[model samples]
Target: MSALDGLLLERVRGLWETVSGVPVTFPPPGSPAAIVTAPGSGLCPPAWVGIVSLGRSALVTAPDAAVARTLRQALSSVPDDALTCPDTVRSVLPVAEVLGPATLAYVTEGTFRPVPDEGDVEHLSVDDPAVSAFLEAAGPTDAEESGLAEVTSPVFVLRTRSGPPLLAAAGYRRWPCRTAHLCVLTAPERRGQGLARRVASAAVAHALTAGLLPQWRARPAASRRVARALGFREVGSQLSVRPELAHRPTGVTEGT
Candidate 1:
């Protein structure tokens, strides 16, 4: 198998096993060059797949063969090395072919590291006025507010020592398969001062304390850097499908 295949197999195998409650060995030890697991009902979250090799082995928890076929055709053209860059996951998917009406997104998976929290960052309850203000005035748009609303835990925000204004905030919510999904937001104007990492580290440290495996799904390089600073490891890339209309390819598809 190619290196990409091996890497993807390692990541998805564990995830598949966890969700399906089944023990499986990818490529079944020296048999064929390809192994595709038959679809099972136990798989949760409908479907999620990752492609590291064109056809060596497909890492999938697909609901049916039709979806799998479309996914395969779409990803067959992806360069093996492209999967290494998590940002390419979105562009590499054959969204129209796979789900037709649904959208597929590429997201980076990250794991948290155990660390001591910086004592200075303040913790805010879900309804704290500061959290509200931060959500309202901090980001240039309402995206940050929506994300913060999804978080199930108390928000952790870092403030400017010079005043009580928000610098950054981080929190977590339950993700598929019982993992903690972390979200971090920094004031657009105060981005470069290490505030993102500071707030994220606090949230991650809290998550670890709660006996949860913290997951960081990042797309931006800056976000990835903050994740790494909080000691989260880049595990692999994932394809996230949702209920949005996918853009159709006008004619035959182009570059990989």
Candidate 2:
């Protein structure tokens, strides 16, 4: 790996280590996956188990020591590359419901290939009503998945010069280790127009200008394509798995 790649990898390792509250050292290539237990860590939706893999090294985190031990034993024979695969995880932990097999990508200023703005890109508050309306039109699944509403940084938006409507918007939340976790959304009808690239470029440029590493975590092929177009390197994968016992209903139903 180049020095720049090594530096970026260390930044990401530090971020996950902080979030998981445990050392997140990746095992050597072709080695058994390393496992640690870190309950209540920032695994989305409070997963019982989480796995992250960089290059050929992988780390598995569980909720407790016992679970970690079990996972270690079960996964000892699995290849590092297979650690993030849902089926591979589910085979060993049958009760696990996987949350993501998202690709973890990062871009450095030296590597960023920004797209030119197709229109005026405006910087707006995260709470802008137009953003909310745009998300509403995009639907709950897209809104939640985009994470646009949760960004702590200024939202970059693209719109028709004559109107208040948004064609696309992007922003980021500052994450541990000087990382900017990006959130981008484009109107469904406005997709394929390169609006996502435009707004995301603005957000990425802003993050880079502030001396922060830009992170793009994506599961969708289209989203990954945009990140690749902007020169983000896909370095790893993240998967969160919730065991059946941990699945609790928010509202209990009475006996019928």
Candidate 3:
């Protein structure tokens, strides 16, 4: 790997270590599949499990040691690159529901190439009523999926000088590791117009200027495309699972 790639990998490992509240170690590239465990971690909701795969190595976080042990044994023989596959995860944790296989992409100042700001792009408080209305117009599913409401940073918007106003909006939530988790959304009608790219560019630039690593966790192809356009590198993936055992009667056991 290039020196830059090595640096980026270190940053990612550090971020996961903080998020998982445990040591995270990666095997050398092309090494046999390997995983590290973080028990009783806050990587996911209580009773849920989270897995992050960075090529030949992965980190698995579970609510408790018992669950972590079960996962470790179950996934022991799986290839590292297949660790994030939903089907593989589901087969091993059959009673659990999988949440994602989101592409975890990141961009550093050296890699970031901001899109040219077009039209009138403005920075506004995340709580601004205009932002709310825009999210509402984007529909419940899209709005919730965008996660714009969770942004702790200023929101960037591209709006129409005339007509229906908000065309697209973007922002980031500051993570504990100084990672900026990006959220971007474009009005359904305005999607193909490059508005998402414009607003997202502004948000990314802000994050970089603040000395934060910009992270893009994208599930949609279009969103991934926007991240790639801004020079974000897809270096890994993340998935969360919640096992049905978590909801069983207190006296119930796994063998039961």
Candidate 4:
């Protein structure tokens, strides 16, 4: 994990090798890790903000504890008048367990499972049509916000005997922790067909094959179903952090 160190830029290879067919990796190394960094594109925030793909996640650490704290401040330091996403810390830190004030732990660890049979379906592609369909079914999809870096990644699709399968999509990011962020979609007409569960199982299969983790933002209605089918446990709640304390100081005693 020291790959977040300022001096280890060259040593840190991109996670593209294990990433899903989503565009979640950093576009390219813009900052040398020795210079100022642009947001969302570089591996660092202000100075270092690592951007992992949809099916992936990232962590950045300063050279030492002091710098890490400084980096933390930069992330949580937003203006009261500034408009921002609730999740925007805008800082650099390896995403550890759930932080203070966070509703639940977003990162979950589990063994990659197996993909079920999807005869005549489940196509792998550089541009995933399946993933495209998946997002349409799953609201609040980030398929559009995907930076150019993500559009260039690989994608996969899964279908059932029914015309349009219940799920399709791509990964934007992936990491050794086995965490993946992808557009998990279910077909509009395929609800209650149990296709999503199967497709999710297939993704898990691919994950096990690649030695990675298959993570999904299950629709509220489908969350319980997907979790059970994929052998995923409710390790913790995946929360949307509140914006009120978005810029609050870190280490102020988390989980209060």
Best candidate, TM-score: 2
Where does model 3 exceed 4 Å of error?
27-42, 246-256
How well does candidate 3 match the true structure in TM-score terms? 0.89
lDDT of 2 by residue, 140-189 (tens): 99999999999989999998779899999999999988889999999998
lDDT of 3 by residue, 60-81 (tens): 7766656655666677777778
- Native-vs-model 1 lDDT? 0.55
Compute the lDDT for candidate 2: 0.84
Candidate 2 deviant stretches above 4 angstroms: 245-256
Model 4 misplaced regions, further than 4 Å? 1-115, 126-154, 159-172, 176-178, 217-221, 240-256
Cα-lDDT of candidate 4: 0.37
TM-score for predicted model 2 compared with the true structure: 0.91
Model 1 Cα RMSD, 1 decimal? 8.1
lDDT of each: 0.55, 0.84, 0.81, 0.37
RMSD of each: 8.1, 5.6, 3.4, 12.0
Give the candidate order by descending lDDT: 2, 3, 1, 4
Cα error, candidate 2, residue 244 (Å)? 3.6
CA displacement after TM-score superposition, residue 10 of candidate 3 (Å): 0.7
Q: Write the per-residue lDDT of candidate 4 for residues 23-54, one digit (tens) a residue.
A: 33332333211211223332222322222211
Tens digit of lDDT per residue, candidate 1, span 1-256?
6675455445544554554433544344323222133344233244443332222332444444545454465556654434323345457553322211111111223434433565778888868888878877854454453377679888988888898877788898865554567878888888888887778777777777776667666666777777776666554443334211244334433222
